[model samples]
Target: MKQIHHILILPDRVVVDDQPVTITTQGADIVTELYRRYMNDYPKFFKMDLLSRLGLVAADILLQTEGAERGAERDDRAVVIVNRHASLNNDRAYEATIQPDNYFPSPSLFVYTLPNVVAGEIAIRNHYLGETACYIAAQEDVEPLIASTFNEHTTSVIGGWLDVTDEKEFIAKLSIWTH
Candidate 1:
């Protein structure tokens, strides 16, 4: 049976190994606080969109320290993330960019309107050049993507429930499954 090696829950909290992280800080600085509390260095984190930011933070918490040293090969790990809003946060922002008043879509903001960008961001951060994909499911849908059951080629999978309704309303519950 596949086992869950680690897990992370966010924007307002961090839970690992089924226990609440007591060392965390809170409020509007949740991500920033968690980044400084758990990560040693990852300056590029600030550049990501809200969705990507949440995904990256969850991935880091799952792959930090001893978990990273496992040295999984480049193609051994796959990233499969699922979200409900499908970058609605970025979508709204992108729409604002192209409005009549603005008349010009911002490239950086336009680029992340796709939901898969969150998965891509995770793959880049963890150096996992394997199968990377994202699924758009309704809040009630349940499809399996976070396991070695993916296909014969993949040995492990990194993914889970990743959703962002907006900056203030979001949750990223991620985990790694090793088969």
Candidate 2:
């Protein structure tokens, strides 16, 4: 049987296993604060989109709290993420760059237009070589989407809802499931 461990990363607080790990009232600063407090060593974080930043931060918190291995390749661990917005935030930014007046599409922003990029970013950061999947679905379908991703080769999974809107509002509810 697989046991699921959960973490909720909100604009004001982060909770793991139903216990608040950190609290702050600042809205947008929570993401950067999480990066600074938990992952200051990864300079690449600054280059990622807001969606990826939220997912990465939530994954880091969930995996660290669960005592999952880090700095090591884990072929048996999979990363699966589902969201309703589907990278709309980055898409809007990229769309703005391609406008007639702006005509300067940013390659950096273009890279994150795909929703799966968030899952890819997390895999690269953690050295997880197992399956990485991202799906765009309704909130109620997220659990099924994540469950369907598991296979015989998968021993553990880091996955959940990672959604960000064009307005910069976001929510990440990640979990680590292990047998």
Candidate 3:
């Protein structure tokens, strides 16, 4: 993980070159809804409703757009970081799933339980075909998260947090690093 090409900060609703990309909520938010939006927008590319499927779906999209930034080439080594704490707001589901004895949860909510779903989404969307990992924290902690994932051949990293509570507030910073 030597090359961090560019770090993009998408705060709230932002238009990147006239394209609409917004972080509307935070904390226990319905991440699936966001997934649906992506599906709707890129119908030709993505068609998924489950978290696992969404992970791969997102990864495919990432490979094409963000992955192309470096040299119009694809690097499966690229990593992605999803800020789960800030983006998840479904406290009810969180509590139910985390119950001591409740191992089997509503399959829908269970998929989002792991923080790495974000990376999964990106990998699925882009078909990155790289090592994928996820981290969970109350706040943003980039050092350890990035360090652990960084490798000598790593070209760049798509890292950030997404939160969706009552309203919706999240930030995903896709940074491109180089050594």
Number of the top candidate by TM-score? 2
Candidate 3 weakest ten by summed lDDT? 8-17
Q: TM-scores across all candidates?
A: 0.86, 0.93, 0.53
- Report the C-alpha lDDT of model 2 over 57-95, residue by residue, as the tens digit: 888877777774579887888898989999888898899
Model 2 clash pairs? Answer: none
Model 1 per-residue lDDT tens digits across residues 65-168: 22558345487778878878888988998898788878888898888989999888887777778898888875344235464346677887877788888767
The best-first sequence of candidates by lDDT reads: 2, 1, 3
lDDT of 3: 0.47
Clashing pairs in 1: none
Residue 173 error for model 2, in Å? 0.4
Residue 162 Cα positional deviation in candidate 2, in Å, after optimal superposition: 0.7
List per-prediction Cα lDDT, in the order shown: 0.74, 0.83, 0.47
> How does residue 76 of candidate 3 score in lDDT?
41
State which candidate, 1 or 2, has the greater lDDT. Answer: 2
